[model samples]
Target: MSAKLYLYPGWLRLWHFSNAILCLILIVTGLSMQYTTQGDSMISFQLAVSLHNICGVIFVFNYVIYFIGNMVTTNGKFYWRNWGGFFKQAITQSRYYLYGNFKGESCPFQVNEEVKFNPLQKIAYVAIMYVMVPLVMLSGIAMLYPDIIIPELNGISGMFLTDLAHIISGFVISIFLLIHIYFCTFGTSATSNFKSIVSGYHD
Candidate 1:
């Protein structure tokens, strides 16, 4: 039998579930606004805009809770890493995903009580949560309040730049979420990690 670890707490699970729901809503609405021609959208333009704004605000608040939770909880420790030989460790993990796993070899970095994320996961999480999130939020806020952004940036519309940034960052986050779900299946069983997120235990 595989070992079990009580890694996820109640608050964390709530945050994860809520965040996932909010992100999905935002993705759908955002796509409707961006890609749909008037009268040809799955969601009406006005309704999509409203839903997108509401979910965006809620997501921002959820992210704030996540930030504070990380600050006060031991869970935050997993995101930090020693820079020494980090790339090599990430490469090993990559090899495991690309080749070793196909050969039925064990993972190079196993999840444990002290280490929840492997090297690549740590790197990806840090970039997404810290860099991309902030960029997207700031850009989104600027877009929401157009006056906050300079009227013209190098003769280009400031709102245009802000919107572009928000779209790109949001796209990156969406891609990350898909990959995250894919990786969740790499646990002991195909559903083990999904169960862990819900039950607060990692198998």
Candidate 2:
């Protein structure tokens, strides 16, 4: 039986929903800009640039709220768990993803009030949220204000390096978002996770 838990608060849900929309817009605009050549692109280069900048700025603020919310609320605890035995737990969870899940074996780690995320999920979330997101944001800021970037970074144009970093990190986040949506389908029912995000309860 699935236990119902009020895991997502109203503010958290709003942040998540807005974050999803902004990320989609940013990713689309980013791709348009990246692929533009001689004024040919999915979206006009000028419009793509404008939308990307607008959404990027909004994402910055939204990320700040997420960081602060994690710090000041219990939500942060899930991501802040001790790393002891993490590798072992991660391996077990990985095995489930690779083998056990296909065999209809129950998950090695189940969600509860104290531990809402499995080991691999927690690690991925930490790395993506704490590390990759910040990297992307900093590189994005540098691109927006070229004047801030040093003229040369290790004999290469700083702007080039900044753009590269931004692209790579953005790509990582885009991939994560896709995988996250796929994983959300794993629940009591195919739509249960989606409904939980809307109603702020996990079943």
Candidate 2 lDDT (Cα, 0 to 1): 0.92
Residue 30 CA displacement from its true place in model 1, Å: 0.5
The models' CA-based lDDT, in order, is 0.91, 0.92
Q: Write the per-residue lDDT of candidate 2 for residues 66-133, one digit (tens) a residue.
A: 99999999999999876789999999999998999899998898778889898988988998999999
TM-score of each: 0.97, 0.96
Score residue 181 of candidate 2 by CA lDDT.
92
Candidate 1 vs. true structure, TM-score:
0.97
Tell how far residue 102 is off in model 1, in angstroms: 0.5
Span of 10 residues, lowest total lDDT, candidate 1: 75-84
